[model samples]
Target: MNTLKQGDAVPNFTAKDEQGNTISLSDYKGKKLVVFFYPKASTPGCTVEACNLRDNYEVLQDQGYELLGVSADSAKRQANFKNKYEFPFPLLADEDKTVINAFGVWGPKKFMGKEYEGIHRMTFLINEKGVVERVIEKVKTKDHAAQILA
Candidate 1:
């Protein structure tokens, strides 16, 4: 998969949400969308990142942005994470890695001197026209939302 550039048109995808609801990228057409891809759900880093987005949800909403999170986690796990955090956004369960691979976020990752294949933390900002406006590749979990907003 090629790394999507700022002007690239986002690939259309349909993914299952925590509630088993099918969500299609087209559903959010004509709206600014923030699609964040993380490695897993409920982990420390993921939790902080999700919470940060939740905390800044109002601000982002005011700016006319819709947020969605994507991970290879199961629907059950995503539900637990969403419910636990009271997340006001959809978390896509990409268990088949279809969305992750489509966005080029699934790749090798190194941790503790070891490397393994996983989802790289990334966020794509898509404009109202469905063209990517930015690709946030270097994410700092603690204040990710602020960084994205910046």
Candidate 2:
């Protein structure tokens, strides 16, 4: 999966959000941003990671970071998951894998005894200038906020 690394320019993308609204990377220009990719919405690990971010949303904002969650799910499913969890941030319905592939987070994944291709759980911390400051590849789902903050 040729994942992006720190110091790389975050690829600009325009994708539909849970509400079917157009969200573009340029919208976050001049702001620190956190773009996270997950395999699916409403799954156990995804839930933990999302909720951790949601719960710590204010603190992250206080630190000048805006959060965005992305997954290869449809808009309807993404909306349902966001509503069900009351997430404060927008969830990108990246069904076409525009953002995912741009970030190079979609690739082979292992589950149980099977191997399949999917979105890897990854997060990119982008600076105000749209350059990646850090890349969190080993995400601790339950303690994701702490990991980001640390």
- Off-target runs (Cα >4 Å) in candidate 1 are none
Residue-wise C-alpha lDDT for candidate 1, range 63-110, written one tens digit per residue: 899999999999999999999999999999999988887788877788
lDDT of 2: 0.94
The 10-residue segment of model 2 with minimum total lDDT is: 141-150
Candidate 1 vs. true structure, TM-score: 0.97
Tell me how candidate 1 scores on lDDT: 0.92
Tens-digit lDDT string for candidate 2 (1-150): 888899999888999999999999999999999999998899999999999999999999999999999999999999999999999999999998999989999999899999999999999999999999999999999999888899
Deviation (Å) of 85 in candidate 2: 0.7
| Per-candidate TM-score against the hidden true structure | 0.97, 0.98
Q: Which candidate tops TM-score? A: 2
Number of clashing pairs, model 1?
0
Residue 97 Cα positional deviation in candidate 2, in Å, after optimal superposition: 0.3
